[model samples]
Target: MNIRFLAQSEYFNGLHLKDDIVLEKEYEQGPFTNLPKVRYFLYYLEENIRKEVMPYTDKVDIFNITDCQSESDYLYFIEYVDMLDRTYTFNIIRYNITDHTHTKIISLKDNLKLYPDNKQIKIFILDDSNLIIQRALPKVSENGKLKEFFDFSLILFNFVKNKQIIIEDENLTRNGIEFILPYSDNNCIMKTGYSLFQNNRHANLTKEEAAVESLFVVNISQFISDLQLEQPNLVMNAIDQSYYDTTVINAKLIENFLIYSKFNYENNDENIIFYDIETKEIYTCINKTTTGEYLLKNATVIEDTPYMIMKNSTGTQFFNLISNEIDATYPVEYNVRFVNNNTVISTIVEKNIFGKETEVVCIHKFPIKKVILQEKGEYIGCVTSDKETSYIFLK
Candidate 1:
């Protein structure tokens, strides 16, 4: 079995986790000699040996691992600031697994533009070819003050092909965007609305207080095609956001179904909405006392499957979108990561007598095994395991 080792000293037998959303951060200036260096290694479980993949360096400020596997070429992004000019430099590197060499695909210097005082920006590396960036642009007032209504822009830059597509709309400028997801292979769905952050005073706001107004599902490939034909207005004119006028959040697209959850203000409960994108048939569940859970933390659609695992204050249920039935109800302890028809991958917390909790990886089907780590870390490292091979990461 092939396994991707992130760090040394301790071995963690869990699937390597991959995050679709990546936020950029600033690092302290200097030599950073006292900091711990984290390196990447490729472990062959059958032979029980690891080969050095990427050595950690002090110059590189940020490292984003796009893809890493022994069977295929690994892709990663490294960003560092130029000390002389104080400019950010980003580079995409493609490493050949078999040959033990890497190639610099593209390097961008001083291209990242941010708001006043470098507020925050999100960088999404969809693949080695496509890179999406979302940043909040400033809206200056007449008195030269920043306004609350900030304009947002989504830029998709294909560094390999050297093509770019920018989407700047009034809707994004007005309401603002919460998150964006890869709809399928060629499309992406953007959710635009305001959010009421969870606090002790007001945990779950009612619908009248905070509600999502618009959700735009755009076909990136089709939009790009229309732009190529010099018909950019066609894609912009096709956007309709009048149907979903409710408090919707955590929207995910699986197959032909757009599954999401909404809050009921009257009963103070949470409800799940199953929307059929093809037939326009929406099926919403009855109100349940599953409110107060944080957004995006309680609900997730299983990757490469037709099921959505939803956790609430009540319990966790595996809802089948195709059959419109609850396949099985699991305890709230088991956090489902990835699932298919044959295999179920999840993590469960095991506590010892001293009240020390250790998260263990549980592989249910295909080949049942419980993988545990010797050293416990606070961060949730990468996880990816399938029928063929598994590559796990740990601190």
Candidate 2:
């Protein structure tokens, strides 16, 4: 079983009084002012034990008490341990003074030596607590002996202020080494060992190295936000026409636009609508399912056409056209049956005034299953199959 104990000591005039001891306030302020309160408290408790049953020995040894604080706050805990174990076992005792309390803990264990010669220890001091670990000697020393022996130096990569890695020596005679790690201006630190030349000392990259590194860390989300902000019109046009596929439009395009737009609409909403010509609709949904709604009013039909227009409620449309110059030699009934079965159905429209008759062709071979006609135009919504459920845009 694991066990822990805590003691509190209060000091009045300095004559530390244990929990069992009863003393008046006036007497505590006078004769007991200079006395060792902790020592007296321990002595009084030991005296109370029956000597015949248990014999006590003068083997108590107090080791070093270390106090440390953690990075978050300044509260501290002091830890004290006994270095001697012989004959009698000990435990912690609490003493109370007028205003404060002092505590001393005791334990029974084999005699243990701390900080032996040639022994190395790692001491982690935090705002509220500390941790000490005995470790083997490090290969490198503050005087750069490791480099001298190995004939190679260890250099820190991506050095930057506030995110520096430091190596310090325990003795004052040895100086410490500090290396700054690179971090973005936004206080975000990049992961180490990214760029071969930037993080590796042996790599010999040339002019393209800087450019490669810049592209590697460019925040895509932030870049897009800034670009849309600065060049609102350009971004709006791109979104309106689904121009994201262009290779020339990179992160820098959006980044510059965002920087420019920052002054005008700092708190504007970021959701956007994208329109694709192939799908012929304003895509609003992204991810999950590949489906979106199209406004029927946005559909257009060319005049003097040879196609029949159909619409649907889910924002889809289809155009049907007939071929005038048919191969009549196959027989009229056979040709009509072939036309009805093999005819293509689609929503795309192509105009050709040079043709003898208005020619309307379907871009897709799937049949139109649903249509919704509105006052403004006709919208072809859903298809006979799932193939027409296409084009998704994310905000």
Candidate 3:
């Protein structure tokens, strides 16, 4: 088992530093000395443990910090600034590690047309250009006291074209820690499944009571201008509750189609469904082996591939629908890419610790399996995406 050593001593792990999101990334700025004034952390252990203190220089009240676990050396954060009046302004700041400088990339000022008194806000960066901002405001209770409830909304903004798509719904829920599981360039999908968020909040989730999940497909290019209203207008609907209370484990937009894998808690099984958005047709992949236990947190579909990649608990596995089999396993948690259905280039990163020494090596392994795709589905869904045209036949 891999264990992560905590950097928290009696120094920083206190109540005072408990409220902030406290985002950290694996970055080294000038030998960890003379670095910015931000809390640093080391995740996943290694040798040559180093520590240093430096003064943080950027002059901004950082509300939250966002870290992208990528090769980028820059750090992005969000801030709320006061502007003389009762209203406030939100800014997305990008800090460059090379020059020790910061830039306010996006400025969302207070406008009467938009929400002015947004109390809490969270920004998630899909890339250098695409981002989504979620904001929440308070709601007063009937007893003349604060109800501790905040209505939330999601706004998809593209910094490349300066286009913003607003998401407004009566039943909207969001988690502060938001991420994008990208399917393509402009297509992004977000889903909220069941249970009603336990007292209308993202924390403290309760089970036993099942709720149907709603899937929303948003194309950023559709709402860029006012003329694209007739372009499907963001199809939002709940999956048919014919079986049990299903929770969405992963969702995606593949070839303009919706492919999702969800676990049914009632039956203790998992099902992968494919729904075509344009044709309103659906298909399901029947698994011969029992799934739903030991799930992978990530669901990534490779380009020009028929199989969906899953980070299996034991190793990396390719879950193919046509073969109805999971084949070709690699080392667990290894950075791997597929050369074909049968072959994978595994970049194994391992740090070998021998007493007072540690040796890190990256080994490439080729594991091949001869697999083919099955065209016809094991089971085709009678469900329709177009609910208006869906007809119920009395049998």
Candidate 4:
């Protein structure tokens, strides 16, 4: 039993059509006698009432009557002023009934009709349990044109929980979009499984090629020399040229050499000591020996006074001193004694030997006792004083 008003107006000549309109239960039998006469009376009453009431500009007055006998038989009347103060009559009917389900169906049909050709539709499917699946690219026509049909296929693979798949295509020439495929049916699909960039610019060298290139281009001797100059405390040595040339022909040999070199260089240098068995003095010497008498100038000798000869446990001849305790002359008779394990040798200068001036001479040697051997079964071994620490291996 509700009534709604809608705007519906028309113009004729220079006059409005609905300037005066009235509604009654029976237009032919009412006291007004006819619809036109009732309309004219409504126009006159509306003018007189408006002049008395003077309603507000923004508000409209609506009157309700509860004494009606039938809700469906109610009537409405409208009256307004014209430019020439003339009157006219018009008729209108109102109804209230709506079907929401029918409206929804019509809307769906209209939306589907908008894309009849299916130009850019895409579809995706997933497998139930297997890791194998097929992917179909967009179908192309014989003339190299893409089909208007949708593009997609089923994906089958074991699902990884709590992980997401991301697809990325940077070139605008290709479709660039990302979507999440839920882990359903115990499987998941990845749009971009493999990386587009697999081949790299750097070429992998073979064993032989690597060895030769590393030896020729790396300048290992220069590297060792630089390390020696920069860090004198580090015990570093380059493999002999013959060894390098032989190993350079094979890449495996170079890798093995690098591995061995790294292990040898990792320890504390102070733990390593160099000893001259022939001279019985602690001094740094090259591994290769030279024939002929070589005098060691600025040598760190044990005693203040010179001695005639020094000997190690191996009965090798060492150095000769030139001065004694009294006049700084070299000792020729007395033999020096070591305190522990033939390591330290010290001379005793008594008052009787030097006539009042007491002096003692001592020699200290390098302490590197054991070298690590990088071979099967054995892990360490000892190296003689004449051999380099790198050449020694555990056996």
TM agreement with the true structure for every prediction: 0.55, 0.15, 0.45, 0.12
Q: Cα lDDT for residue 367, model 3?
A: 35
- Tell me how candidate 2 scores on lDDT: 0.21
- CA displacement after TM-score superposition, residue 388 of candidate 1 (Å): 8.4
Ranking, TM-score, top scorer first: 1, 3, 2, 4
RMSD of 2: 32.2
Q: Write the per-residue lDDT of candidate 1 for residues 257-342, one digit (tens) a residue.
A: 56666654446666566666657676555445644452333333443334546667655576665577776665567665554333
**Ranked candidates, highest lDDT first:** 1, 3, 4, 2
Across 186-298, the per-residue lDDT of candidate 2 in tens digits comes to 21111111122112211232222211111112232342343323332212112211111110111111111110000001222121222222232332211121121222222
To one decimal, what is the Cα RMSD in angstroms of model 1 from the true structure? 8.0
Per-residue alpha-carbon lDDT of model 3 for 239-326, expressed as tens digits? Answer: 4332134555565554545776666555666666766655656656533335444222233233323454666578777665446567
Question: Any runs in candidate 2 off by more than 4 Å, and if so which?
Answer: 1-114, 120-122, 125-395
Could you list the CA RMSD of all candidates, in the order they appear?
8.0, 32.2, 15.0, 46.6
Model 1, position 199: C-alpha lDDT score: 27
* Global Cα lDDT for candidate 3: 0.42
Clash number for every model?
7, 37, 1, 20
Error of 3 at 114 (Å): 21
Q: Which ten residues in a row have the lowest lDDT in candidate 4?
A: 100-109
